[model samples]
Target: MAEMIEYNCPSCGGKLEFDSTSQKMKCPFCDSIFEIDTIQQYYAEMENSDKSTMNWDTQAGTEWQDGEADKIGVYSCQSCGGDIVADSTTAASKCPYCDNPVVMTGSLSGDLKPDFVIPFKLDKKAAKEALNRYLDGKRLLPKVFRTENHIDEIKGVYVPVWLFDAGVNARMMYKAEKRRMWSDASYSYTETSYYSAVRAGKIDFELVPVDGSTKMDDDIMESIEPYRFNEAVDFQTAYLSGYMADRYDVSAEESIKRANERIKKSTEQIFAQTVKGYSSVVNESSRINLTNGKAKYALYPVWMLNTTWNGNKYTFAMNGQTGKFVGNLPVDKSAAIRWFAGITAVATAVLFGLSFLL
Candidate 1:
């Protein structure tokens, strides 16, 4: 059985939920709020609490006849003591009996704990509004998608990611050419000068994030390019109160290949910027060496929506910090045909007018 933790309001003992607007835990019943720092102490004590009192008598419950409960996991809610049944990958969830947010402490313990977390900055309401704005000017989007999509299904999640930092030393050689053209009364002259350019420098990159969960599509995650790491705080289970979180199943070692690829690409681009003031430049040879590479486990906030339209499921993701939204929408074939037809008609009319004038 997994252990669950819940935050309760100190003032009125009501269930405390994290409020995005206030950036604090607010009690729904008493309206009292507490800052994150204050909650940190409570979390510390919970972490250091004695485990001897947690032993449960296993002989009381009925045994599973066979492999019936293989995929199921049960957790004891700290607040209501109700059994919270969840899948193996669920790190955080809400208790149905008492309606309090619960975090699976065992999943986030020891080596699995995240180092940093970006709390939810945009609430669920903002996500819905962003979805509306996303669909507003999309002329070719299916009209029925707007009416049939489930907006309320949108959820805020703290997605696990690996933030990699490294210092790169690169030496690159480029072949560049400068061309000059001159025209005289009798003859035209053209001269081209070729030069070999070499650039060597050291550059550092910080917090290059790669999605750590296999369940999230890497392309969509990359499309929402950048979460502000400056706003990230030390990870606390309290911050995940009202949201769902995934414990990273992908090891940091497995993610190092992706991190290296991104760092190498960035190093090449930055070095290429230095080779300028030429008509054209092409890379001749390049060598890059990386040092002090490190990876940190962190959670970034994202608002995700999954909807099915016309028998195809669409997934949308929004950056909770920056409010950037991205998703692939189904295009209406009829509307696309009409739009292309209009373009063709205009082009033919313009060509005919030009021929008549000539």
Candidate 2:
């Protein structure tokens, strides 16, 4: 049976929440910090003690008691397992979750729904203003791209993501060097010392999010990071009334690889910063053992726009809550060439004038 589990703080019988800023599980009642491993172990022992199995009837769509279902039409995207709901009169031409063509299909009866969602704080007008601001003050951008390229689509989407919580045991070694120099009347002398540095520690990572959509670019998505987890609320189908959402097509297992990569990189960098007082430090080897590796499914809000120019597509995305915008626009090659030539001409002319004066 599908069960919703809430982790309680061991220090006090209160709900334990993942604090994004501190990257730890904090108990509001007792003001205690905990490693996620402790909670996972507790849940595991509880499951083992009670071995009875139960089946639950999980209905996908929300039951409509007010006869509002007649006006709501649900469609699915073929490229990605994105379920889109809109008004019956409005045609869903593209999947807002991934910006791909939509194919009408039945509701996701077997899909796992998100546990939490961060509703859109910024509206379409804010997104439009942000897009315009992003286009402004860019001289290299083609004038036509800024003015004539119509935004093919702009959508507010609840993107699927996997949030990972883990406690990691890390060991890192580095080759460090110290340099000293002395100058005498006859010659200069230099001395260098090399040493091996080793460090090991345990650190916790809370709510490290990885986008769970196949069509979304990982790098581009990461650029708009750091959703305030504190603002997330219990998931409800009513939140999807005016927005689009999707069930994860990429499983948590597939998404874990990227999370691990990012966590490992972060661990190494954080530890390296601790090794100070050395002129130079280079990583020799590092190892990380992850424990309490847990994943929570969530939906994050994003304002997305897609347009085509010169047979190529350009996409822009904004964090619906923070208004952090990120997208790569097409560069004007002719404009760049002209700029380069103008700078070179001015430099050469100045040099010639100086030579004549001399």
Instruction: Show the lowest summed lDDT stretch of 10 residues, model 2.
Output: 101-110
Q: How close is every model to the real structure, measured as TM-score?
A: 0.88, 0.69
Q: Candidate 2: which pairs clash?
A: none
Query: How badly does each model clash, as a count of residue pairs?
Result: 0, 0
Model 2: residue 336 alpha-carbon error in angstroms? 1.3
Which ranges of candidate 2 are over 4 A from the true structure?
A: 1-111, 345-358
Q: After superposition, how far is residue 73 of candidate 1 from its true place, in Å?
A: 4.0
lDDT of 1: 0.85
Which prediction has the highest TM-score against the true structure?
1
Per-residue alpha-carbon lDDT of candidate 2 for residues 134-190, written as tens digits (9 for 90 to 100): 999998999999878789989877778999998889999999999999999999998
